[model samples]
Target: MVKRLTKHGNSLALVIDRGVLDLLEIDADTPLSMTTDGKCLIVTPVRDPERQKQFRAALEEGHRKYGKMLKRLAD
Candidate 1:
């Protein structure tokens, strides 16, 4: 599907269609990454909130289990 960019304040925005939104399982607040691959613009959905929370919890657990060793190394 093609979309037109419209002026939004000082920036341009594209309105995504509902079908595409449903297929991507994304809402208006969903984070997106925009990059240029030489000639084309690449847009992708960023990490979901649940996955981010799980990763953070895992990192905290790892730190709790190995914090003393890390501190010793730092010293």
Candidate 2:
């Protein structure tokens, strides 16, 4: 879908469609991090640092607890 940037005082803004918003599970107030990879523009939701840390810790704990079962299943 094509989008046009609208003037927002000094900056420009793109109006995100509702489908995109729902798919991304983001709202107008959600913070997003943007970057470019020399060719394409990349936009992603910014995970809260504290929440991310908690998630990583939980994932590590789960891996440790389930590693044996998972390894057995894989064999």
Candidate 3:
């Protein structure tokens, strides 16, 4: 599907269709990252809530196991 870029403030914005949004599992408030890979543009959701929670838990576990070493290094 093709979407036209519409004027938003001083910039043009491409409005994504509902079907594409649903397929990508993204909502209005979803955080996104945009980058260019050579001639192509890549857009991705930043993180899923469950994945982020798991990541935080792992980070905390690492801190618990290596707290002293980390503190010593910082000093």
Count of backbone clashes, every candidate in sequence: 0, 0, 0
Candidate 1: 10-residue stretch with minimal lDDT:
40-49
Clashing pairs in 3: none
What number of backbone clashes does candidate 3 have, counting pairs of residues 3 or more apart or in separate chains? 0
Give a tens-digit lDDT track for model 1, residues 1-75.
777899999999888889999999988898999999799888889977899999999999999999999999999
lDDT of 3 by residue, 1-75 (tens): 656889999999889988899999999999999999799778899987899999999999999999999999999
TM-score of 1: 0.59
TM-score of each: 0.59, 0.63, 0.60
RMSD of 3: 7.9
Clashing residue pairs in candidate 2 (N, C-alpha, C atoms within 3 angstroms): none
Q: Which stretches of candidate 2 lie over 4 Å from their true place?
A: 59-75
Residue 52, candidate 2: Cα error in Å is 0.9
